[model samples]
Target: MKNISWIGIYPALLTPFTENDEIDYPLFQINLDAQIEAGVDGIIIGGSLGEASTITAEEKREFLKYCVKTLEGKKTPVIINVAEQSTKVAIAMALEAEELGADGIMLLPPLKYKADDDEVVTYFKAVAAATKLPILIYNNPVDYGIRVTLAMFEELLPYANVQAVKESTRDLANITNMLNKFGDRFKILGGVDTISLESLMLGSHGLVAGLVDAFPRETVAMYKLVKAKRYDEAVAIYRWFMPLLELDIHPKLVQYIKLAATAEGIGSEHVRAPRLPLKGAERERVLKIINDAIANRVALPDYKNL
Candidate 1:
């Protein structure tokens, strides 16, 4: 119900699974605290990076409760992803998230089914009407195959709770178009992990970053530097970060990111089934990339301390 500002590096926190593929609540709590402690602006509880598709409804609700409880009295607002297949299910999740005391919800137009534009628009509006929680419109057509265009935004015009958008269109022009067309009506959070610097350089409001899961402080440091108008410094950090950030857009992003996060000591290299752990040549290659970064990790300058 409250207006939660959607900006800055929302890590899209990875869900830690146990050795037997159960939800590891304790490890999830540790990862959440590390991200909040590292100074991210907001926390998106269950997102694509969080492996929301594989996570059960009960797990989602429990995670939302965990976020609300752990981040109690904090400025960092916790938002959960509601990417259900049915409108009814999505609306139910939205209402439940609000009831469970989440700061906001991110809606990714009915997952799995390639719904038509009008159908997608209607689904988003219905969920918006079902709850008072502030909503972030996740427009990642690249992965979801339903790009929420400006026309869709026009249809969402009636909903005051449609406060922000996760722009993963992977096109810088879309950012300009959204800004020029809507003129700040919707806050824009860069969704693609690889192009975060480009997004901020072109004036995006902030980022819903994937790389932040592994390198929380480094991600936050880049955000702080960019916002402070230190473009050169920000670019330097981005240059060093791009190799790992690009992992977020890959096919095995779940496995890759979990490995990276584990390397940082915040989570386990565990993923729910249907998705498996990286192995053999694929495993060795990914580990080398992650290990190299770990060895020469950026000494993020004072952003956390200051």
Candidate 2:
């Protein structure tokens, strides 16, 4: 299995699409470069923010290959999201990610089907058994309808490759509970952007951020500042970032974040069908928030030196 630190800002990268609705590799590379320059520790492709459901498996494989090839000697790990409905397919995707040089895989519970606790564990265990890549359980019961409870993780303990978790439960105490119960067993990453700082303050290993696609510098700065115990500096950035971060919690987050990224000149608003560009008052409203933040964007300090 590959080694992943599972620490610092790992952007849940937004998939930039062309007006033709295909994966925009050129634009994608641009955003990837920007992320790297911003000091992101890792990259998560084909995740919720990446509009995973609409992205074809072929596209995902190609994207993974592109990312691996692009980051060849950069020392940044690219972890693909495995959000399949079946254990077999999930395992297949995980294996493919490993084959394509992904450092790890973030596995979600069986998608769209509300599996019980035991079934969820079985699904994760089956995938873990099939792949050598490290697994980060994406525990977002709020949006996904299934939570990988601590007891469930206890069952998954035997799988040594199941190394980390993207904690999006919106329940801060679970952070403490995981630490109290299992101490350093699984690295915990803050998944929700709005509460990510709180999660870090509670001892999360890192952040899987959404807005980082557009605002990578600030996002990375916030993480670096927090880790350096510069709470005041981190909080100032987080305060100005609150409105934009809230965009990650919505149902139309893919579109919303894409708009923000577009405003930053890093991405476009193009998206796959069944999902469309934000329009009418919604577009204007979201743009106002993005514009306001840009207008008053905080001047980042020498976070890189921290």
Candidate 3:
């Protein structure tokens, strides 16, 4: 397996859906094009931002296939998020992604039930063993209630395919410790949008951001500034984007982001069951926030609206 670098801005793309809650393949294509135009380094599909938890295993496979086919012969690498409740299911998805020509596989800790560090390590090793593709470990303790300790990541580093990690724990010390120890080996990607700039400044290779699903241009611009070593300019952009990033922690984040995308005319705000659309005053409030943010230059689109 080739080494996959998780550098620069990679949006955890939201799944586009029609009003009937069916996958809108055309809209999905448009969104992908928009992201590429905005200059993202890579694309992450079927992640938390993509509502993977609500999607079936078959849907996941189809989505990965579609993405690989769509981006075929392109420079952008596609990373498929294959985090299922069952390790077997996750491994199956990983193998399917590899077979479909995906560049890498990203996995989250088992969310249905919390497991100890040893179990988590074993789970990742099993998934990694299933395919020769590069693997990215997604560590989001807040959402999964499970933490992959620094030691755990250290243990998994021996696996040649385990090349990167998405650290969403929001603990600076943990990030510092990881960078201090394994900086040369594993590429660290900041999973939380809120801390993306800070994480980059602190030596994180890139961001796997959900907010970038809505504000790709600004997010990518900030990363570019940092890449140029212009800390002052990057901080200004980061501060401007703080409010939009704050929306990622919202319980209705998927709805909020989709609504924001709709406001920009990129896609619909339609989400799956157990994740209903924003309703009543709450809907209006979020819509206004998204619109106002766009007006104020927080979430500007790269393309001209029709």
* Highest-scoring model, lDDT: 2
Task: Go through the candidates in order and give the C-alpha RMSD of each one to the true structure.
Answer: 1.4, 0.8, 3.1
The whole-model lDDT of each prediction reads 0.87, 0.93, 0.82
- Model 1 regions more than 4 Å off: 304-306
- Per-residue lDDT for 1-306 in model 1, tens only? 686767678878898999988889889878877887888888897787788878888888887887788888989888998888899988888888888998898889887899999999999989999999999999988887999999999989889999999999998899999998898889999999888988988878899988788888889999988888877878888888877987998999989999898988888988988888988999889889889877777667787544
- Candidate 1 whole-model C-alpha lDDT, 0 to 1: 0.87
TM-score per candidate: 0.96, 0.98, 0.94
The clash count of every prediction, one per candidate, is 0, 0, 0
| C-alpha RMSD of candidate 3 | 3.1
Of 2 and 3, the candidate ahead on TM-score is 2
Candidate 2: C-alpha lDDT: 0.93
Please give the range of 10 consecutive residues that has the lowest summed lDDT in model 1: 297-306
Better of 1 and 2 by TM-score: 2
lDDT of 2 by residue, 80-176 (tens): 9999889989888888888889999999999878999999999999999999999999999999999889999999999999999999999999999
Clashes of 3: 0
Alpha carbon deviation, residue 154, candidate 1 (Å): 1.7
